[model samples]
Target: MTVMKSVPEAAYGILLRNQCDSALDEAVEQVRNLGYAVLNSGYSDIELQAISDQFDSARERYVDAYGEAKLRSIDEYHSVRSPLTHGGGVFLNLAMNGNLLSVLKKLIPGKFILNQQNCVINPPQENYNQGAWHRDLPYQHFVSTQPIAINALFCVDDFTSENGATFVLPASHKAEAFPSAAYVRKNAVQLEAEAGSFLLLDCMLFHAGGFNRSQSVRRAVNHVYNIPYFKQQINIPNNMQGADLSPEMKEILGFDYMEPASIADYLLTREAKKY
Candidate 1:
């Protein structure tokens, strides 16, 4: 004779297995319930160093290309946009990490696009543009049944109280309107995490970068991944044309979701096109 557990018992066992099998289940749940979560990327010291170096080089190259005056004039200073186009392999590798992707897959169903990837630097004791509270999907004031996008910010340096770490209003993703100032003051939490850890948040969550009171600058790489229904911040497939990328990465970057040029093109399958 054999015995089978009840439905609730079986479900509990499956959930336990999922939690144990992947270290990210709890973190994912936190993001679902609280609008944010901190996740470790599990990269080695040497790898994290490479990523840091890449971030510095990318920012320098961007400044050189655009000129500091031009960047400041446009209010885009200290930020490197689309670093993956010019950054080293480490940047791309971090974007394609299996663990991070796994957490994303759990949160967002179906195909998603890399809306944008940029490097942000917070200067010590200086007022930065991102210091104010805002949602990643700015200007939108509605709540969705599920997350439309996720922001995975990789901390290049250890995020500390002195070095501007991120701060968020917990569970604000469920609220359609921003909370009162008094509520924010009481509920806001500063997230301090080690280098190489990701400060993951729902795109709708209201978050801001804390002021860096330390003597050193703090750097972070931000990646916004959203469902393909929304347009990318930049035309990634067109911008990174001729660049070598794995098939999965290509699809994730919106290669498969690009709009067709003509009726014939529209009729063709995604694979048949040369995009």
Candidate 2:
């Protein structure tokens, strides 16, 4: 996949409003090219506000449940939202339709996993500074891969330049690994999008959460989707059974009535194979 030469956000909305698959294809291409992309859609102020309340309630529940993690030192490191949510986010998953998941699946194929990541950030007070630059996908994990891995960043709070919005290197997904030691030849950019902007990024791209100079807590949710056969650190383990979903929805969740098969069954025989 290559960087989309044109900005597809406007076209994406136009096409999506019309349910144009062809336009979505173009948008997918565009997302690939840029090495990362952001979709500012399907969210309203009311929606974001509600999500904020959920997070607040979650924090209280987290303290009640985890007990130890509520401590000032321990709670800070709870990047993922599962324990915090008291077993939720999956409901948020259900809110995302299978139609959308199917579209992403077709665009990315057997290379993506759902509900694999989350983040809740609290900036340090009394003059905080930078976070070390890094890529979302580690070096050993990909073992030097070029196919784009995506990390979905959903802003629970408004991502401003003042606050700790994520910064990314556009088109840096081509980089072999996290170029931590190298000096970037160009200026790194901060994604100053508003709340609910789902920032989808290629895992190879170099990025980090910028320093939050604001007083308010800066919260963001990260969902890293990777290619199949790769090691998965986090997974969506929620029970979908009896959930308000159609048969098609379950299929996207890999519940398509699959049977076990041997590796030999999948491979071509030596005699039939063309070397």
Candidate 3:
């Protein structure tokens, strides 16, 4: 089996420099080399606080609809799916973040679609396991000539080793075959980052969340983006119906680039003059 080479530790220093277009390019190179990169201070403290507040409000609503016990049984912890529907304003801002988008464009050159927006809350508990090791795009073994999917995990709470920080197998994105269970256990490294940091990852990378052994909960918002040809995990356009949105937001949500397939579609395209 072929194994991908890992990036050197020194390359991560590029992310610590001043914010500029060159720095963003360096960060993207780090992602290509290591399968992931951590951007410290990607969001402001105030922005992070707003995200946490929105998460708390959404959690309450989820609990009211689905009992806490039911939620716990579904997964190791609580997670809000398609959070943009509930946390639209704040998450929309995050999706369109200038710096973040710049880095993403490097990975996926042309127009891309927002596939998913999920918020995960890992509460403290003894022997708590987040989930089995898995990929966001599971069961696919072939490597794409270009990136097919990518993830931006925004930390809402400082991720510590004790609080279920994510564990990743460096350079695994380029591997053509999956590693053995023992091999994975032996090589996976814990990723610790502060609140307001962004953990950008190639979706095919092997990773899993660490067990939360702290006194408080760990929170994060996960954004998964993909090539335009693939359908979004959620119908973002339908979800935002009747809501006001900017042209760029509509484009990212896939309103502007719907491919015309049938004669009816061509007629609609002509009527709207989208092409």
Candidate 4:
């Protein structure tokens, strides 16, 4: 892949707003040019504090129920899967935020669905790297005509170089091979942002989390969105069965749309819609 020698000015700390056409355009351009875009102040101070509190409460409960040792045995870092299932109202509201949805709509034209949601907590430790460089998509050495998947990372705490900020190879989304060691050494850049900022990443971009050398912990929530044709990591509709959900929530969760399995079923669906 070809790397941009200079970062686009619009890629740094772009402020996001609901229904702002120019801001949305700039964000899209930056992502296209650099494979990622940073939006500062994605959430308010009150919202960030509430999310942090909720995360703490949830972490305590998880540790109590499963034991800290058990969690660590599963992985080197503390990761909570499907936080939306139990993250309460604050997380639900954040998932459905208008500004976030607007930006996603611009990046992904037509219908999209929530593919995965998880929280990663990287506490200070020696050699604290979580995973090797990888793409969110299961496939490799492939390029899509349009963006098939994207990640929206919400920083629950300030992301700094010492606290394990994400590192990305700019414009690597177009690459058909893994980055060489020398190329990565020269091109990889750390993304540092304040709490409540959003880092929108192209799913194919080669990236990894940096080591946490600081005394403080780093926390982030990753929400991956994909085109509706792809299968979700978790069956959200089945898991959400019997829960009260609004129309918008149902749509975002992919409960309101589906591909027909057969021609007869497709015909039936169209015929039913006519009534």
Each model's backbone clash number? 0, 4, 0, 0
Q: Return the lDDT, model 3, position 273.
A: 72
The clash tally of candidate 2 reads 4
Please list the Cα RMSD from the true structure of every candidate, rounded to 1 decimal place. Answer: 7.1, 8.5, 6.3, 6.2
Q: What digit string (tens of lDDT, one per residue) describes model 1 on residues 68-107? A: 9999998899789888877777777888877789999999
Among all windows of ten consecutive residues in candidate 3, which has the lowest summed lDDT?
11-20
Q: How does each model score on lDDT?
A: 0.90, 0.57, 0.80, 0.80
Judge candidate 3 at residue 181 and give its lDDT: 83
Residue pairs with colliding backbones in model 4 are none
Which segments of model 3 are wrong by more than 4 Å?
A: 1-21, 126-130, 257-263, 270-275
Q: How much does candidate 2 score in TM-score?
A: 0.68
The TM-score of candidate 4 is 0.84
RMSD in angstroms between candidate 2 and the native structure over all alpha carbons? 8.5
Report the lDDT tens digits of candidate 3 across residue range 129-204. 4456777888888777677888898888898998989999988999978898898878898999988888889988
For candidate 3, the C-alpha RMSD (Å) to the true structure equals 6.3
In model 2, the runs with Cα more than 4 Å from the true position are 1-27, 68-78, 83-91, 94-103, 124-130, 141-148, 180-182, 238-275
Q: Could you estimate the TM-score for every candidate?
A: 0.90, 0.68, 0.84, 0.84
Q: Which model, 2 or 3, shows the larger TM-score?
A: 3
